[model samples]
Target chain A: METFADSLDTPSVVVDLDLVRANIRRFQAYADANGFKVRPHIKTHKLPLIADMQIAAGAIGITCQKVSEAEAMVAGSSAITDVLITYNIVGAEKLARLAALARKVRLSVVADSADVVDGLSRTFAGEASPLRVLVECDTGANRCGVASPEDAAALARRIAVAPGLAFGGLMTYPPAGGEAAVQDFMSKAKALIEAEGLTVPVITSGGTPTMMHAAEAPVVTEYRPGTYVYNDRSLVMRGACGWDDCALTVLATVVSVPAANRAIIDAGSKALTSDLLGLTGYGHVLGRDDLAIDQLSEEHGRLVSTGPIGLKVGDRLRIVPNHACVVTNMVDEVYLIEAGQPAPRKVPVAARGRIR
Target chain B: METFADSLDTPSVVVDLDLVRANIRRFQAYADANGFKVRPHIKTHKLPLIADMQIAAGAIGITCQKVSEAEAMVAGSSAITDVLITYNIVGAEKLARLAALARKVRLSVVADSADVVDGLSRTFAGEASPLRVLVECDTGANRCGVASPEDAAALARRIAVAPGLAFGGLMTYPPAGGEAAVQDFMSKAKALIEAEGLTVPVITSGGTPTMMHAAEAPVVTEYRPGTYVYNDRSLVMRGACGWDDCALTVLATVVSVPAANRAIIDAGSKALTSDLLGLTGYGHVLGRDDLAIDQLSEEHGRLVSTGPIGLKVGDRLRIVPNHACVVTNMVDEVYLIEAGQPAPRKVPVAARGRIR
Candidate 1:
């Protein structure tokens, strides 16, 4: 008998719009009740359709990592007018692109150094509107931020006086489970900036692992969580969401059952991605947790079990990948099972390959 | 001061055409002297230009892991005719695509089960020409293959009698440093199939790690290597290629120097992939191995050192990623540094996101 999923090619990403809607509503409610604004990061889904859904569900804005992504998102959707790119963007070519993107959306960016500030000021010096620049704080994440709150204040002061730049506020991708650090660092930075006679408009903090505890950092005026809309095994392992809450899964087919304990699926690192994120296996096989996805080549996934891996050839399985963000970036089109739609609709990943 | 590399956006892949030509010429010469057919796998560069260079250097067609990759490679280049898809083309959608691809070129695929053969037979039962099918054998890779030589012979016989299928040969993605096993298993399988009055015309073995020792397995007729065109840190560590021979390098700009020991680059997992490949760092920073690419978020790569990290914001660095194949798939366009040209040329990654 023909099935609803037959239209989708195997090793393709399948995102349930119902789960996405529920996830967006749940997180939006949590953020609203907690007195924090939700700015869903489009890096996880990389789709303008879901960004529109998040906005429809009362999200304040969307977050993008690159100017190209912001351009693609704003061009693809009619609702996403605000975008915050949380990175220290350097170089002239990207700065011009950033200036062009700033003209389209209410743009804000993060910076941790004088070089990035000067570069931005150089590009946007003569623009009609000043660029909103945020001071990125460490907050114990140690990825891209200033070392201390003093450095954050210093950067904030630099941005406030830079040509064609306005000191927006503070931003940090805080360490997972480090709400106290976020509260401590951001509060200190806000105090320092206030003492400098500058008003910190919006303090932004991002990360899916600490979205629930975002209220702990009361100074954080906005919450940016990318992965909650399409939670994966990493988020589930951290108790951020349940298995049923996962919106994105790789739809694969069993092409080889070579042994009693081994079965091979058509999906591999190319489809599922190689982002382990401290997970033992590649993904959580939906209904087959007993089976471990042991290894992945570019085009083959090895599923092994202690006993008979009861899977046969042509059997289909859905894998919630290790990192949903990276998985979505691997494919061109994702199969969407939207609410009220009987069949899966294929949607192109609009912001894919916008790494620059 | 402005430089020639200024035209390139930060976190962009740069492929040196000079090095690619040299690498392809060197490998093709080695294969010629060893009397083995070099069917260069296009997964690493994913560019038809490089594929054309490989063919000009006397490669026997190209190797693609998916139907879409094959389609992109064939469509982009004018000099390609033969293609080999080293994967079990499963499901009706892909089978139909595979059938369509076969009509345009000399196409062949590998399978390890009767089910895969049946799927192909059902799709191409009444085609004008029978599809070429190779029995995938297990030479200790333990990923996707029939278990033993006897199983290989049985599958070969199954394909021999299947309608609209011709038993072409045998293929295996053997384990690294397992040339003896490839010789032992493939020889035994060939003898068994020949005893059954079936001709095993071509015996294919693939893997970049064991490409140099491919001739130890005298029964192998073709050697497929994907990573030789652009050697990465993994290949350099394995003594396969030197650092200077690496054709592809991620051109990134230092966005933050957070501390004396920490710096951050614009490239992250979205630019440089998270494929560790058992390496200590995400990539090898050109001329600065002292800095370890400690961590990667979506758009930030943290570089840490034990002592004073002299890097400043706005400084440019090129990284030879841990795995070049995965890195090429992360972006849509790459900067090409041709030999005669003074500046870099932008080229779209034509076969990127061809996972399906």
Candidate 2:
């Protein structure tokens, strides 16, 4: 029955702003200690306000996976100087958007094919400035990017000769390894590109799980790890961060006491999201390891207790989502809570649902 | 390699201006045929644009589960004259939003306890109009609402005399059963209120799954169903509607040809969403029941095939989501596709992610 005009109702996203600041500083310091440039991935926290804080705290640039996310971030923060678009810029419409962004800021994007390079070339042919391009090599992750060093070099050569494209460097997202595979992949890619008498300035490689390993990789100059700032359930399960390091949580209220051992919360898939990454359930209840959210309806979350849940009717609980990236796209706004505060400062999740 | 726009993305939330119109007409016709007033729930498609279409097709008003959704429906549609908020307005902040919305439109909400009624009374005590309230009697969903008829009547009496509140009538969301439990519960609640010399004029009950059988319930005078517009897998699996009657589908592209039998797609939880309602895998591949979306990453959908899937790289396919309501909140726009047309009109998902 408490009314804080800013305190959102049940099934709302709550962001810990103080924790986010600490996470940013920790990652930034880690990157500095290892002689790697921190291009903190903006895909984790799409809000421009948070991006401003990260950039101000000594992030070399920001990395965005979608053009819409990059567009939203730049529109909100004109102060951000460097932005590395870490996705393949395919299709004419997206290439045109990328070219326009090049005129606005120091923009760079990655591609793994010659056809994509040609598309970017034609789109930026008459633009005021050229778009920076990087050939994405597949060290592992196997989702996108070229397979071998030969393919990466071929793409780099195409970018060098394209009408309005400048070859920036080589980039690869290796799987979880102790820097050996990343260093080998980067060394081979750099050698192949330099064999064509082209200098690869920036070699980017990093994921949240292998950020520390990638930072220690001698061949990589820049790193792009997204979920490290807002550690999620997947990150905790992967031993990247502890539960206390997670900055984002879904606040839900117990709406139903179906049974003595079972209760349903108001937060469902619409709030907690349905991105379970091989995890047991949708999310983990904060401060309660004994309990698990068993099932989720569109508007109801069924939670089963191991012991006594220690929860009653109308009780509020914070849940760390399975994956924070997908959770960010499920709401319009999120409340920012300072450390050790019951009341949170209202902050608009400005780019919450920009999934284009 | 097709592109929509910066604002309008393809494979987005499409409000079939025509199908939505037809759906509204059909649901309203059903309500009229059954002698029930239609208060169409807007939670399924959280858009004021579609709410206006429902009103144009003779909806009594609109039903929203969130105050944020109600605010959007009121702001977007002038024809939505009355708004019944279906969820419990718990906190002070949401109560203020609900009371403020009451000033703009004919607002009604549900409550099951004196504490909630007292909260509403405290917010709008000196307002021009008393807050319209309905007792949410739990039929069988076991999510929220009062348990028994006596509990319903007690809350009704408290609201009838409560300051700045009016006892409207009784509302129960009967589960999947027809008249098994809901009919009896509502009848007893009506008798109790009538014995107290009070008229239970508005005995509303209905959900998408129970709407068909709801018409025959003698105690129910009105119906409120949301997902009837776009029936999902749950509805179809329940034998509610045929596959042809379902309106929504997610269009995705095969981005990776990893193996002969396995492939990856660009659309993942971030795109199609992973709201699997006890169904196997994430969603159903249209026209290919054998092909299952076995797993989903943040932006990668791992599709498993029985025999090569006969799908080539760069091929686009439509996927029927497990649940349509959660998918609506994950995008900003939707494409209204024709039966055989190459292009579709871009309809803005006006109220996407309006979760407060």
Candidate 3:
């Protein structure tokens, strides 16, 4: 029998629905048993259908990285009533959109600096409901957020006193293998915030690699895991999830068998993405561990064989890309593969290109 | 007076229409003077409006990488009559789409293997007009193409004798400094094919780095240059075009100034892309040679300064990415900056995700 995956075109994203639900239930069950709220990041699978599935499986809310992404999720389904934008919201246009989205849903934003908080204050000063704000602590990520617990406390105090803003808590996206540091950082920040006569209702820390050990940080009230819904090669390499748990795979055809050792596929950087994530090569070809995607142009993926390979043109292969979040943003539609279905149903990546 | 670019959102693609026209005319003029046909690759801009502009400036046709992309261009505008898909067409779905598109326009495709040609021949066998096919030859890129002149001749002969196929000629995407080898390979292939009583009408060779030296190869009758329309940092590094010749820039906002020398922008891999292309960092921060975009997540670009920088929160910066072709594919829309316009006109990237 021809499966739904077999009927799709080359260079398409095929998501196994069974694996998606299983991954979601497993993560949600872990979070539930650990007394932590699960706010799944929608950036991994930028689809409302998947977000709805996450919410139905006992998620507190959905975490988005951009205002437009939050808006797309809210517009796609009413189940996403609570949204936490994890990026520093800046500029008048984005602030206005943020304010409008806050009016429609329980919206909260993160800010590492006072300028971002000031912008939020000016945008929502006279609104009926004050906007919730979280001070982002660095927690060893060294990317965004305040450096020390003192800075986090100061930013939280600033957000507390800002007009039409409520200091929600502290949030951090720690680096991989920095769970111990995150625990120490968040504990110190929580103590500092409590010393200032403020209650830290929520201390959220997240990273796919450190998600399993999230409970090790006693101060964290919630965990936001994005890649768990659709595990990728990066997650597999980090030992966060096994290879069999990967729900998403890019279906591609070997368009050209140029030589005995080199086969080119239709998927390229535009499909699989160029986010190496400190890994060598591009992606892992399923059922062909010997073949490595050595190179990629915009529209062609070069798969090189480690040994003699019997691949030919027109042969189809599925690849687990290094990073699934960036790949989700690359395509407008993805195929949903369900067991016993005649064909995979096409779902619009509703939040794709919503990188405002 | 604020310019159109100043009034728009951050992390958006701002294309200077004047520079786009100038770049198109400059390359077309060079190709015209040197007796080479100009078939601008639509994968760079992916907009029918830009494709129409290239055709108006004297391009013989447009080159596409996928069947869906060609379909989008042909459906968007009537100016794109001739489309040369430089990738091999495979599968029943894509072959049917290729046959349908061939009926609408002057369509031709390239194949490096017998399987691809056989699929194309099977799809177009009973059609009124035979589909044109070109044998893609490997001139040293070693990505996708026939191995040698002998293989190229054999594929050309197979394509010529196929039921509903016409041998167009030879095509290649030569490596950046491989002009001499391309000349040698194409000349020998042309002679071999001619010995079999087949006319090599179009010997198409292209690459932005080797575009200026394309005329050095006497056998190449046509050139397809994609990134020349919006020159990037890679092109600048190769001495193909100057920094001032670059027409595309990603307008990003400094969302947070965490430290004295560290600034974070709202654009990341989703905007700038992760195509290092053998260069360090993500992109060239325009006007700030002292700053480097050292890291990128999905929505955050980390700019670390080599010295004391004057940039602050909410300040905007323009970046010239390393690869313009991949960056263009990441966005759904781009702002067109025309002279004297109060607001930059927004145009949908008509063929953004047509990776079928």
Better of 2 and 3 by TM-score: 3
Docking quality class, candidate 2: acceptable
Cα displacement (Å) at residue A230, model 2: 2.0
- Model 3 scores a C-alpha lDDT of 0.90
Better of 1 and 3 by TM-score: 3
**Candidate 1, which segments miss by more than 4 Å at Cα?**
A1-3, B1-4
Candidate 1, after superposition: displacement of residue B79 in Å?
2.4
Ranking by DockQ: 3, 1, 2
By TM-score: ranked, best first: 3, 1, 2
Q: For candidate 1, what is the DockQ-based docking class?
A: medium
Q: What is the DockQ of each candidate?
A: 0.79, 0.34, 0.83
Encode model 3's per-residue lDDT on B86-186: one tens digit a residue: 99998989888888998899999999988989998999998999999999999989899999999999999999999999999999999987789989999
- C-alpha positional error of residue B33 in candidate 3 after TM-score superposition, expressed in Å: 2.2
TM-score of chain A of each: 0.98, 0.94, 0.98
Q: Which residue pairs come into collision in candidate 1? A: none
- TM-score of each model's B chain? 0.98, 0.93, 0.98
Give TM per candidate: 0.97, 0.86, 0.98
lDDT of 3 by residue, A135-211 (tens): 99888778889999999999999999999999999999998778788889999998999998999988888878778
In the range A1-356, model 1's lDDT, one tens digit per residue, is: 12446777788798988899999998899888989899989999999999999999999999998888888999999899999999888887888888998888899998988989998999999999999999888888777789898988999999999999999999988889888998899888889999989999999998898688888888889999999999999999988888999989998999899899999998988888888999898998998879999899888899999999999999999898989999988888888886678788889999987887
Alpha carbon lDDT of each predicted model: 0.89, 0.77, 0.90
